[model samples]
Target chain A: DAGVTQSPTHLIKTRGQQVTLRCSPKSGHDTVSWYQQALGQGPQFIFQYYEEEERQRGNFPDRFSGHQFPNYSSELNVNALLLGDSALYLCASSFASQPGNEKLFFGSGTQLSVL
Target chain B: AQTVTQSQPEMSVQEAETVTLSCTYDTSESDYYLFWYKQPPSRQMILVIRQEAYKQQNATENRFSVNFQKAAKSFSLKISDSQLGDAAMYFCAYKGRYGNKLVFGAGTILRVKS
Candidate 1:
């Protein structure tokens, strides 16, 4: 079975520009979550999507948004990117939205560089 | 909000030796889960081990085990017979029983010397 997969292994964008990163959830998984890992820091939750709707979101601002397609794939969009946005964007997929069953399978993250 | 903390930013151990990475968390919820994830140089986050709050017995996976102290809110990972391949950034993560959201610690960089 395939694990989670993310596109655009690396990217570079200037401040105020936008970027969209894609993710394909693991097979048999229906929930997708996005995380941002800055240099020297742990991954921080961005948001989660289930059944094509956002189920939970972290402390991130409105500039960060995401969508889940019917097939359980996801896309994370960061608008008006700041230099601070430069980080590794990770995508994790789980079988369900429940807590105990939410063992996440993460993809090799997309490295975003904002100038 | 629940918070996880890893006191040690870096740790080192000789090959074939044992090393323990420490973690502590704060949460008002009675039920939750703790996880240890390893991110290698390739940057893929892999789950090392996990423990449910209700389970008193420590969770073990092969050479990796966790010392879960419910009262102290501590979860430490012990890697035995470490190898050079064990070197990676280990992160401690927590999630409450009600939601799937995870709060992670700053991460501990482990170096296994050959």
Candidate 2:
């Protein structure tokens, strides 16, 4: 089975520019979540999408937003990016039906570099 | 709000030896899940082992085991007979009973010396 896949393994943009990272969740999974991993740091939750609607969000600013298509693919958009936005964006997917035992499968992540 | 912390920034162990990575979390919820994820240089977060808060017995997967102390809100990963492939950044994550969002620690880099 194909695992969670993210596009544009690496991206570079200047400050104030906008960036959109894409993610295709693992087969048989419906829920998609986004995370940010700064250098030498662990992944931090950004937001989660279930049933095509945002279910939960972290403490991120409004510049960070995401969408989940009917096919279970997701896109993370960052507007007015700052240099601090330069980090690895990880996409994780799980089954929404499984509440307590939900296991997340992560993608290789898109490395965004803001200049 | 929930938070996870990994006190150790880095740890080293000789080949075939064992090492333990420490983690502590704070959560008001009575039920939650703890996970240890391994991220290699390739950068994919892979689940190493997981422990549910309600389970008193420590969760073990092959050579990977977790010491889950519910009262202390501490969860530590112990890797036995470590291998070269085990050299990676290990992260401790938390998920409450109602949500899927994970709270992660700063991560601990494990180095295996041959």
Candidate 3:
């Protein structure tokens, strides 16, 4: 079975510009979550999407937003990007029924560079 | 609020030897979950192991095992017979019973020397 897949392996954008990264959830998974990993640091949760709505969100600012399609694919959008926004954006997928018991399958991640 | 902490920023071990990564968390919830995720150079976050708060028995996966101390709020990962493939950044993560988001530690970099 296919695991999680993310598009735009790498991209560069300037400050104040917006970028959208895409993710295809793993086979048989319904929930999708996005995370931002700074250089040499662990990933910080951005938000989670279930049933086409955001179920939970982290401490990120409003500039960060996400969307989940009916097929369980997701897209993370960052507006007015800043230098700090340059990081690896990872996408993880899991089943909602299992909740905390289910292991998250992650994609290789899209590397975003903000100038 | 839930927080995870990894004390060791970096650790090294000889091949075939064992290495332990330390982690501690703070959470008021009686039921929660803990996880150890390994990110190699490829940048894919792989789940190494997981532990449920209510389970008294420790969680183990192949060569990876966790020492879970719920009272002390400590969770440590022990890798046995370490190999070069095990070299990566290991992150400790926590999630409360009612929430779906995961709080992660700063991570500990492990290097296996042959």
- The candidate 3 chain B region of ten consecutive residues with least summed lDDT is B94-103
Q: Can you write out model 3's per-residue Cα lDDT over A39-111, one digit (the tens) per residue?
A: 9888999999999999989999999999999999999999999999999999999999996576789999999
**CA lDDT, every prediction?**
0.95, 0.95, 0.95
What is residue A12's positional error in candidate 3, in angstroms? 0.6
User: Could you give the C-alpha RMSD of every candidate to the true structure, in order shown?
Assistant: 0.9, 0.7, 0.8
Across residues B24-73, which tens digit of lDDT does each residue of candidate 1 receive? 99999998889999999999999999999999999999999999999999
DockQ of each: 0.79, 0.88, 0.78
- What candidate 1 gets wrong by more than 4 Å, as runs, is A97-99
Model 2 chain B poorest ten-residue lDDT run: B94-103
- Candidate 3 structure quality by residue, lDDT tens digits, B1-114: 888999999999999999999999999999999999999989999999999999999999999999999999999999999999999999999988768888899999999999
TM-score (0 to 1) of chain B for each candidate: 0.98, 0.99, 0.99
Which order, best to worst by DockQ?
2, 1, 3
Task: Give the Å error, residue B49, model 1.
Answer: 0.5
Local accuracy of candidate 1 as per-residue lDDT tens digits, A13-101: 99999999999999999999999999999999999999999999999999999999999999999999999999999999998845564
Task: After superposing candidate 2 on the true structure, give the runs of residues whose Cα lies further than 4 Å from its correct spot.
Answer: none
TM-score of each: 0.98, 0.98, 0.98
- Fnat for every candidate: 0.74, 0.88, 0.72
Off by over 4 Å in 3: none
Question: Candidate 2 vs candidate 3: which has greater DockQ?
Answer: 2
